[model samples]
Target: MAAVTWSRARCWCPSLLQVFRLPVAKLYLGRPTMRASQQDFENAMNQVKLLKKDPGNEVKLRLYALYKQATEGPCNMPKPGVFDFVNKAKWDAWNALGSLPKETARQNYVDLVSSLSSSSEASSQGKRGADEKAQESKGILVTSEDGITKITFNRPTKKNAITFQMYQDIILALKNASTDNTVIAVFTGTGDYYCSGNDLTNFTSATGGIEEAASKGAVVLREFVNSFIDFPKPLVAVVNGPAVGISVTLLGLFDAVYASDRATFHTPFSHLGQSPEACSSYTFPKMMGSAKAAEMLLFGKKLTAREAWAQGLVTEVFPESTFETEVWTRLKTYAKLPPNAMRISKELIRKNEKEKLHAVNAEECTTLQAQWLSEECINAIMSFVSRKPKL
Candidate 1:
């Protein structure tokens, strides 16, 4: 029998499976038959609905294939057309099981569901513990209202500098907002500064050497930015004050950016001996000219609100005194629009470039991983921490 090519199936499918991979077990011959009753399969199906979190795309696909095999015996239906992306993926997944017996498929399905439930319970406990601490710290705040979900960076004293936990928090928040009944999502920061960017301590506090630390950080950073790129709903950035580093770099991925007149945008990658990330290398030049993008990314030039607006980086600028009121009012009205219409329209607009963005994000993160391991980057980070500069 032919083995399943899961990697190819995952790449073609525009689904959650792209986030992570799950191991596939090889099929063995002369295995003892394990009979699974219909009631057992039914129970497993119900259990899946009660899962606290999604089992991710790969697992879901496996479950789907197994379920189909159990119910229908085999994938006898004709394959879907290429343009039928969803059905094509579903067909491919189910067909990969080949001629596995229904009883075997049923048994596998039950086993998978049981494993998922047990793991889910353990994961929930750990998540609750981490969430409790995050709540107490109030480092990141997430709230939904009037069809709009808001994710706020709350560490004003630290200029909302992002920590590893904050990165995870934001990624989770964005993931939740993407599937929730929200028409739009907005990013903002509390207090005077929008965001001071990554906490240098994130690097300094690494338990492993630079190479290992850089690898791990790169993985997290890639997922963080991927969350933004794959968000289905409209994403808006409210630049309340000075925005630096990744915060500024990521604005290029937002559907719209509203900045206060006092707000500033800066990406000082070279100063830190690092390369541009968040796909800014692609987005920056595309938004403005290469020379201008070079000035900000390569030479550490910062832009005022008006300057950013002129460069096509910002949607609009509001007076500092009335920024919040103005931005909120507009967003509330925007939220009143038909949610599905907005989402589908956004998807249509992004379809052509979505693949490109993902490719660019991967390339940027890989490059950044190397830069993070460089001696110059380590020295710059150490020096910055030693000075204890006010973020």
Candidate 2:
């Protein structure tokens, strides 16, 4: 059998689980590479179905897309029309794979299920931690009105730097908006700056030893980026001022990105002695071409709003005085449209990248977590914190 045929056969067969200890990938030359155990994949799939709360539309579509792609190879059906929201979303998600082979899709499915299962279990064990409560007072401010959900980074005194709890809050807010049928779009912004990536103080102050803190911090950040990857609704970012670190990378995931005339964006991963986050490794190159992505990630080039717009990284730029009003007006226009239609359209646009993004996120997190423990990262953080003024 051809490699694709064999992979599809194994994916569809349950009895094969009894014979093989794990899923196997056959090389073009006929050698088998060990992958996840069949039992492991099945268990992850089952856990997904058993989870109490819905994983929201994007995740549901992702699961369906991955399952179909793994079992049936690339989509062979005709694309659905625009008005057929349900089938269109499903079709687009599956068809986005184009001609992706079966084994790769299976591996992607396995990775997604494992991540979701872990997240669900963690939620079930706790309602909300102290960190969440501590930050509830002022970190992330969420307000919804007239179909618009606005999530603002409110820690301006600290240049809108995000803490672990703030990350969790933002993820929850986004997930909540995804389920709220009335919520047509989500707008993220900040007072003086978009965000300063993360608060290094929070990371260093984490309890236990340095290694434990780094590991736990990496886990939290991974969950945050994964949530962004699966955000279902139209995410719109209003870059009111400067954005740094993950904040800059995350703009690639937004469906619409508007910026103030004074807005600036930069990712200091290379300068910080850390790897990229938020799957920017893939999304950036796709959005701005490989040459530009290399400059941003490798050289830490900062771009003004106009520069970003010219480079196709931003949708538009407006004066600081009118930026919020203009962005809200645009969001309201989208909110007035058919919610299902809007969601399906966004999904279709993002569907092709779904699996590849998850894979990249997994790889990035592993490397990032290791980097977090490195002497270079430790010294960098120490110097930044002890310096006269923060970076």
Candidate 3:
């Protein structure tokens, strides 16, 4: 969800607020002091499901509001029309919360569930959180600490190749982070390889052939890229190992990128017979000169961490032995500063490019969707897939 804007939310709120006689101050009062810990979240959500009796409409509405706020951030959707009574009630319940921080809502959800489950034994209550549904994340693992929300690509066995589902999961993670005031920044990293880009097998195994893949891929890719473009908080990338394809191109969007000496960046868009996604077409040339951008995007040159740093593509390249510790120490220190200052600074620097980036993303997606169905792209993929691996 996008950050809640007073301008947008107020479109339907003036008369509604008057009708409810709810002072604006009421919305700000009585919020939980802190976010629910991971364990608290898991325990509360467990009890949320185990309640023997249906918590009536009022409580159910409260639950729905809290859950949405917790998982998706502020209520940014348009207010339901008066004629849509059911949805209006639901929307009103959520909108009433009024800019409550996601973390606070999470703790409130936990408190509400705990209060509801007081009659039951702890052992008998459920112990699941919505997040635990993915026992082993196919690729992405999301965690939060202090003010940093880390979205790690965890499929080291597969060189952290991205799947369609992984893209969706990442989009969701970014959305959740964007609205959470506690989340000062998003840190992306991988344990082994940063990412090898899309797993071809994920596309090949689709129900239909390249046509179906292209159509679906276009939609998902656009959504994923837009999530990055619209991300409200700082985005930081820690490149632990080599990155390929979109992984490298995406560094253009990050507020800061720290890489290990061992890390390298590569983009094989031309080799794949496809064009860029994620607005790299715009951001790349602006960050690095057009010549360097052409070398990476058009000529498919690999860039070592030090080389990328010299070209202004990477923020810093640390020694491999202390990369993680050094990068995180810097991040934690930055995370401690006043968040609004950084946010405003970032906006001032990049705000002018926002619309152009969106336009470039649209053009790229259109070209890419068309390219996906081209004979050249299909033949190139097939040729790459058919080659035998070195023993």
Best by TM-score: 1
Query: Would you estimate the TM-scores of all the predictions?
Result: 0.71, 0.69, 0.67
Which pairs clash inside model 2? none
lDDT tens digits, residues 255-352, model 3? 88999999999888888788877888888888788999999899988999999999898999999999888988888887888665565466556666
Q: Name the regions of candidate 3 deviating beyond 4 angstroms.
A: 1-136, 388-391
Q: Candidate 1 has what TM-score?
A: 0.71
* Worst ten in a row by lDDT for model 2: 22-31
State the TM-score for model 3: 0.67
Global lDDT of each model?
A: 0.79, 0.70, 0.71
- The residue-by-residue lDDT of candidate 2 on 252-303, one tens digit each, is 8788788899888888787677888888888888788999999899898999
- Segments in model 2 whose C-alpha atoms lie over 4 Å from true places: 1-137, 388-390
Model 1 misplaced stretches (Cα beyond 4 Å): 1-137, 389-391
RMSD score of candidate 3 (Å): 12.0
> Residue 309 of model 2: what lDDT?
93
Error of 2 at 70 (Å): 14
Each prediction's Cα RMSD?
Answer: 10.2, 9.9, 12.0
- Output the worst ten-in-a-row residue range by lDDT, candidate 3: 17-26
